[model samples]
Target chain A: MILVFCELKDGQIRKPSAEALSEGRRLADASGKKVGALFAGASCAGAAEAAKFGADVILTAEGATLASYSSDAFAQLLADAVKAKGATVLLAAATAVGKDVLPRAAARLGAGYASDVTGLSMADGKLQAVRPVYAGKAFATTTFASAVQTATTRPNVFPAAEKAGAGAVETLAAPAGDFKSVVKEILAKAGGKVDLSEANVIVSGGRGMKDGANFKILEELADALGGVVGASRAAVDAGWGLPHSMQVGQTGKVVSPTLYIACGISGAIQHIAGMSGSKFIVAINKDPEAPIFKLANYGIVGDLFEVVPELTKAAKAMGIGSN
Target chain B: MKILVALKQVPDTETKIKVAADGKSLDPADVKWITSPYDEYALEEAIRLKEGKGAEVVALSVGGDTAKDVLKNALALGADSAVLLKGDGQGDAFAVAQMIAAYAKDKGFDLILCGNKGLGGDNAAMGPMLAELLGIAQANVIVKLELGEGTFKAEREIEGGSEIVEGALPAVITAQKGLNEPRYASLKGIMAAKKKTIEELDAAAVTAGAQVSALALPPERPAGRLLQGDASQQAQALLQALKDEAKVF
Candidate 1:
């Protein structure tokens, strides 16, 4: 059997979980095995959603101990589940939580593991995966040599399929393990800022924004467009952004937003490595010679202080992002 | 307190990577090597902890002699000592983690640090895998950290926000960017580093669990069609393109 770990956020199944399920289904079909899903948390409210993406069985573990993410606990639970199901292949989305838990679980099981895989296939009853290395500059095809194969797929890479399955949910007791670290508190970002990795639209600033206060203009524009505000490493290094979480560059979050607007940002190769995957790019800068113009779908050579407000007014008048 | 920081050397991010004739590796002819950027953050954090709490910082790396450069750089940046796990072949994450864990097992360290992920592999497997092998707790991708007596509080970035986590001593942490600003090596520090000797050890023999069959570059994106007009006209055109062509808005 092949197993996929379905991740949940606030009791709802995430998109990446569905994608992993779809990939799991493909792999299972190729290997002539059944595809199963494991959902462990305080609640397994979205087991049905996993079925929609082609999970034959949904294994759930719910208890107070499983309410929050603890690496040791989750790894133990996953290792137990893999053993109980006799799963030969395991998959999960390569999110922060998944990346933290999967490697530990693989280590416990003594299984071959790969991370951030973009392509997966089964050949001769063995798993093959392709993952980006060197920050997406190159791809490497890897084949597992252990008895059990495990990998975590990168988010937004695979298309989720809505092929319904039985999705029979089975509740299992949470595995007991030693827990040394625990989450004390989760501090949610104010203003409901979308995560840079998952945002559909992103407006980013750089050192040309001058200072921290000037970022307010970019934030306003982002809010008006129903997008999130991002910063180049230069802006973050210059202390123009409060948290480094908003940074978008090679050393920061790699984003592939649908629309990425570069405001007053000079495009460094590191920065380009992160956002070059955006479907559409817009560059607004005072320097026409800025490297950002080379990658932008639209370029405006003007003072961003003036150009940005004008663009914001135009977007507002057109009801561009009232949603 | 004694801290161990795991470091790796990688090709400079800006270098034009050319796939070697072997079809599974980069051509090493003209590649410029530097310490992984994120590892610098780990090294810097260790130096800060050493300065603040009278800790001894030891930097470690796994590779051939080229990796010695990274340890030397770490020494120049204020690490008290450095060690190189002498290995010339590529090992999967599991093998690499096992080697490091074996070396760290007998060493009494209060904390272990590494980059969240190395730029060369982008695997993000070493730290957590090492933690598992050592049977210790870990805080991955931590941006802010506060260490106390045998305890630590770390803040890690998640999807929509950050979470504050607490772990006890002998914990492993993978440093994220922005954890600290890495300091430059001064003349005095460089001179001192030149005099310091880097300890070399043989890596435990382990078979690679994963085999790489091929290496290829991603398909290049088509050149963007630049819009022509004033700022307002360009904005209007972009909006139209979003609605009509991209269908994103």
Candidate 2:
């Protein structure tokens, strides 16, 4: 069986986890294997969605220990689930939680892991994973040498597919863990804003944004485009009160948006690596020589203060990104 | 208190990459290696702890001879000693963790530190894997950490916000970007670091769980175009291009 760690947020299946489960479904089809979607918590409520993604078996690992999010406990739960099912492969979306817990589970299972993988396929009964390396300049094709293989797919790189499945639900016994670490509290952000990792289009700012107040214009543009606002490392580190979640760079989030509109961003290699995978790039800068112009398919060498409002008006008129 | 900081050297973040003739790895000839920036934060945190509370900070790295440069830098940055686990640098994160776990198993270190991830591979797996292999608890990508007698309160970065986690001593904490600003090696420290004897040790034979079959550059983007005329004209052309040529939104 190919097991997917179907991550959930607020009892709903995260969009990226759906993509991972669908990837598992594809691999299972290729290999004539069963696809199992495993959700860990005090109790799970999203098995139906998992089934839509082709989970032949919905496995739930539940207990009070898992009521709250804890990487230590979750890793133990995943390792136990993989063992109980006698699964040979494990898959997940490379979100913050997936990246945190999957490796620890791999350690327990002695599984070889490829992280932040952008591509996956079954080749001669083995899993071949492709991941971006060297700040997205190169891609490496890696394969697991261990019996149990694990990989986490990058968000937005894989599309989710839905198909009917048996949808048999099974409750997994939670592992008793004297957990080493526990999350005491989570300081949550305000709701309704799109997450940068999943946004199809991004309007990003940099030091050229001048100050945090300047970001309001970018936010207005982003809202019109049905996208999110992102920031370069320089802007994020400038102590402008920009949340690090919106940071796009080597040290921050690596995003693959469909349209990346870089405003006031001078295209540092660090920032470039994160957003280089965007399908189309647009640069708005007063200086024509900014490195960002080289990557942008459309460039406007003019002041952003004037150009941005006009662009927002145009995008709104076009109904861009609005479903 | 004794803290061991594990460092991995990667190609400098700015270097343009070329695949080697082997088709499975980077071309070493053109690559200039530097200590992964995140690991520098790990080393910096350890040094700060040493300065605040008397402690022994040992720097550990796994790689071939070129990796020694990273260890020397760590020494100059105030690590009391350094150890190089000599290997061919062909191992994956799991193999490296196995070696480090073996070395640290019996040591009476109160804590261990490493970067959340290496830059080149961008696999943020080693620290957690190492902690699991050593049978200890771990906190990863931590931006803030407070150590107590036998416990720690660490704030780690998640997607939307921060989560504060608490763990006991003898735990592994991986450093994130905001952990601390790493200090540069002073001239006096650099000279002293040069004279300091680095403990070289043969690494245990470990098996790599993954192997790279081929390496290739991502498809190059088509050459970009500069919009002509004034800002209004440029915006108009850009929207047209998006609708006709790019077709993105």
Candidate 1 residue-wise lDDT, A1-323, digit = tens: 89999888776778877888899998888889999999988778867678888889999998877877888788878888999999989899988788988998888887778898889999899899998777666778999888889999877778888888888888889856448787778989887666888788999998888998888888878877889999988888885545688888777888877789999899988788778767788898888889999888777787788778777887798888796
Model 1 quality (TM-score): 0.94
Clashing pairs in 1: none
Q: Which number leads on lDDT?
A: 2
User: On a 0 to 1 DockQ scale, where is model 1?
Assistant: 0.65
Candidate 2, residues A162-191, lDDT tens digits: the string is: 887788999988767667888889877776
Candidates, DockQ? 0.65, 0.72
**Most TM-score-accurate candidate:** 2
- Predicted complex 2: CAPRI docking category: medium
lDDT of 2 by residue, B1-249 (tens): 999999998988778888888898888887889999999999999999999987999999998888999999999989999999997544488888888998999998889999999988888999999999988889999999999988999999877677898989899999998888899999999998998878999887876777788999999788888888876777778888988888775
Error of 2 at B59 (Å): 0.5
